[model samples]
Target: MATYDLIVVGAGALGAFHAYHAAKAGQRVLLLEKDQYPIGATVRNFGQVVPSGLAGRWFEYGRRSLEIYRDIQSQTDLTVRANGTVYIASDSDEWVLANELYDRYQAIGYPCELLSKLQCLTKYPLLQPDYVVGGLFFPDELSVEPEQMIHRLIAFAQKKYGVDYRPGSVVVDCQSNYGGAILTLANKQRFQAGRVLICSGHEVRLLFPEQLADAGLVVSKLQMLLVEPVAGVTLPGNMLTGLTIRRYESFQECPSYASIPKPEHLAELQKWGIHILFKQAIDGSFIVGDSHEYADATKAEDLGFHTQDYINQLMLTEARRIVTFPLEVRKTWAGFYSQTKAEIFEYDVDENIRIITGIGGKGMSSGAGYAEASIREMGL
Candidate 1:
């Protein structure tokens, strides 16, 4: 029998981050994951640490993460790209919204710039003027190779802080007994830990249904695509469109939303079809997304990838407005993340066991910050 100070289940972004901080804090930590490789939402979507789409405290946290990511390439073996971000508005109304967000972000000391349509076109000719009116730019945003990020974090934890990793070790049960917790794995192996932090995403309920029963936590499926960049065209950094402003916290937190006509905005929402976020990869390819669909009863097969007719048409229609190159679609995929009706899903399953989940879809942006907070809360 082996013992540790903390046992973190799930090796997705959240779990990996928690394990990293715990190990750095000198606690004997064990991280368990059912898959040999991380194959969840953590690595499925764009590896963007978006500072512009987060709320008050989360926005600050994202800024800090962006700073960490910028320095991480030198501090560790992680692959980080600080290419910044751009938000394009397709019409005058949306331009008003973009200016409103830019002004508010500036007031709060967030690094951003409001760009005119001509300025955007002159800087990046791939953008078709018909699809864009103006653009907002964030000079501090960044992107990472999601798979590379996880692997580097794992390596950093192991080589630098001595964290124990147990991939393919599925946690079947966890319970608090006496002063500690007993964790039973799928192979009938049992381990003890002074504290247990469940960073499991959508599967959190499968392990502790009774505890999280009241939290209205559920899984959301998102579809994303990767496209080959048109030759000679380069996106300065990451990119978002007016649609992103409407869906993400970037617009909702701004005064623009308050002044926008509700009926007109709602109509625009339907017209855009889905949120459009674009980031150029180190390979010169662009990763774009995404569509949101939720249901109480989710089928494994229902998570299949298909060219969403509406989303595909809308993205291509909009991408041309922002980029100069002729884009060609490459690959498409779907991802799932836990979404809670509340701010976050944090509760003690028992005295020594705590379950923390539900970061909505902003895990990549806030994963590290949340992990640091979770470890501190556990007194590790």
Candidate 2:
């Protein structure tokens, strides 16, 4: 058996970050992925690294993740662009919540600006004038190319940090003991390590299905779209509409969050759990998404991995209403992540085995920081 300091499963954003942190700390880590490369929720959603939207420990982690990103990028070629983010409000109701969040940011002395209708349009001229009343511009937020960031991160870890990355390996059997854990791969290969960190998102069942099930793990499905870029289109950063205010937990910290005004005209949209966000990819093509649905976490794949036309129609309709770009759905798909009622579901099954997944949609936003903290707290 090849022994190492730590073993990581999943190889997604969370797993990759865990392995990266472990390796950076001088721990020899064996990072395993079931697929040849990760094609799960990690790469499927918008790569918006917005620390300003996270609160408490997660917010701190996000800041650390940014620092780490810069650290790694300085030593290597991984790129994290400072594109920033803007949350636009279409009417008085969304504007009410927007100001509430801005007030909280002002009180905390965060470097962010609340933009009036004129300023918002001046910044992002691409936006439809009638659709935006105001916006909150978070200049510190960063973004990455979601589809390629992990693959590049994995390469950086392996080349620069010497993290032993093993792709296309699935752990069929995992046995934990006081001294260490033994993982048996489907190909009958075995790896022994002092501890195991399971960051497997939906596949946590492959290792500890019982723990995941007992934790009441549910799957949150998101239907997303990538629209063909217009001949000439530009955005301030990632754009979050009024829907995100109700969806993201960070906004809850504002004193007026609980009592933020609600626009009754959007009742139907809210009923379907639809939210609109626009992010421009590195290639300049825009990514627009998304609608949410819930199902038994274990049955998410059985539900299908393709987009639902009805949901996409609803999403595109809303997207058009918010901004105009001669939008055409160049591509459509669905991604699912583990969801729980808690901030994040991280647990230790034993002295030598740990699990960290079920971060919901925040994985792309605050995941790296969360993983770094997890490694430090465990003294790994």
Give a tens-digit lDDT track for model 2, residues 112-220.
8899999988888888899988999888788888888898899999987899999999898889866699999998999999999998887756888888887767788
Model 1 per-residue lDDT tens digits across residues 257-300: 76765446346335534677787787888887777766442233
Query: In TM-score terms, which candidate is top?
Result: 2
Q: Which numbered prediction scores highest in lDDT against the true structure?
A: 2
* Residue 280 error, candidate 1, Å: 1.4
**lDDT at 295 for candidate 1?**
46
After superposition, candidate 2 runs with Cα above 4 Å error: none
Give the C-alpha miss distance for residue 315 in model 1, angstroms. 3.2
User: For residue 167, what is the lDDT in candidate 1?
Assistant: 92
Please give the range of 10 consecutive residues that has the lowest summed lDDT in model 2.
Answer: 254-263
RMSD in angstroms between candidate 2 and the native structure over all alpha carbons: 1.5
